[model samples]
Target: MKDKPWRREQRFYSFSTDLPTRYADMDTERHVNNVAVLTLHAEARSRLHLALFGRDEWLARTHALRPAKLQTDFLEIAHYPGDVAAGVSLVSLDPHQYTLAIGLFQDGACVGLQECRIGHWHEGAWTQLPALLLDRLQRFGLTEDVQ
Candidate 1:
């Protein structure tokens, strides 16, 4: 079978961090619920932002991001009382838009995958990315055009 795209992305991960699967994150089945998966993605990406741009830069940024598309595929059940980590990669980048790919892993196995397109809004319009920021993004492996 053809390899999934995100599988090739592990090496290019911009950032990754452990994320506790709180008891509240589990559903009736005792596995992580779908909504919590989204939270994990957000947390991972936020951590990246904090690391790369710092809190002040992030807070003062003028671009407002709106989710354009979100695709999630659940591959396996993620059980609690186990190790969990989140990995994030910049799949596409634009001045006022970009896409991120995230993975939720439990016990060293990927349990969920998500790819989301976040559109940027600046001054009531889609803005172009500054050259320096674009260079940084490319360094983080956003080597292709925005999708």
Candidate 2:
């Protein structure tokens, strides 16, 4: 679960939002739980979608946008009693899907990295994303030039 160099830098993310850390999210080790961090990433991703498509369009189910695959790496333990900055960027885009790169940052350092593939499904098969949607997604690409 090695993370790319740019994934550790919060400035590289095109979209970012702060999320409050909850006391219940802590584990027995006194660190924030991995599942809780993943939930933060999900919220961050939703923000990105909301920003790109607005609330109504984002919530619409006519053209379902669902995660097809996900890969995550925990780089460091996040402590409680502080806000976590969840960042998201469009890393890869295709005709039918796009990959979102997520970073969870605390105290100016990234604590985790996540890559999720979200796709549009129509009927029983994959469908091409609308050109307007693709155009909107392109505006939120990661600032870093990563391979």
Candidate 3:
């Protein structure tokens, strides 16, 4: 499937990290292990959260945003000992819910895509997102020019 065209008009918050694929990340077929994809998704999500909220302590003390679901599609095989760039985009917005779109690119080609749904957890329940949190997320959406 083709990737959705990024809506560049919205402001998207992004961060890039160079990740080295380890030997252990390779499966018997000689490509990066399927399980390793989850680790990359986790790392990307953590970085995006940190960029938006500043730090883990800040999140625990103030923000109610929590990941509710994650889905990933592997478009191509990634080999061990290679570098990958992960780009995250805010694809949709809602008061209580949002979706983050992540693309793992290698050599300028997308190797995988991940979509994460995040929701606010409050008062022992998943509640409608607070205005403050929604405002914070809006800043992470990609700008029209960038998309």
Q: Candidate 1 deviates by what RMSD? A: 3.6
1-147: candidate 2 lDDT, tens digit per residue: 254686788887888899999999999999999899889888999988888888888888435888889999998899899999998888788788999988999988889999999988878877888777787887665455475
Tens-place lDDT digits, model 3, residues 88-129: 777678877888877776666677777888888888898987
Residue 8, candidate 1: alpha-carbon lDDT = 36
- The global C-alpha lDDT for each of the candidates, from Candidate 1 onward, is 0.70, 0.84, 0.70
Among these predicted structures, which one has the highest lDDT? 2
Higher-scoring candidate on lDDT, 1 or 2: 2
Candidate 1 overall lDDT versus native: 0.70
Note the residue pairs that clash in candidate 2.
none
- State every prediction's TM-score relative to the real structure: 0.79, 0.89, 0.77
RMSD of each: 3.6, 2.0, 4.1
Local distance difference test, candidate 2 = 0.84
Off by over 4 Å in 1: 1-12, 130-132, 143-147
Put the candidates in TM-score order, highest first. Answer: 2, 1, 3
Q: Highest TM-score: which candidate?
A: 2
Alpha carbon lDDT at 57, candidate 1: 69
Name model 2 segments beyond 4 Å from true: 1-3, 61-63, 141-144
Candidate 3 lDDT for residue 16: 64
If both were scored by TM-score, which would come out higher, candidate 2 or candidate 3? 2
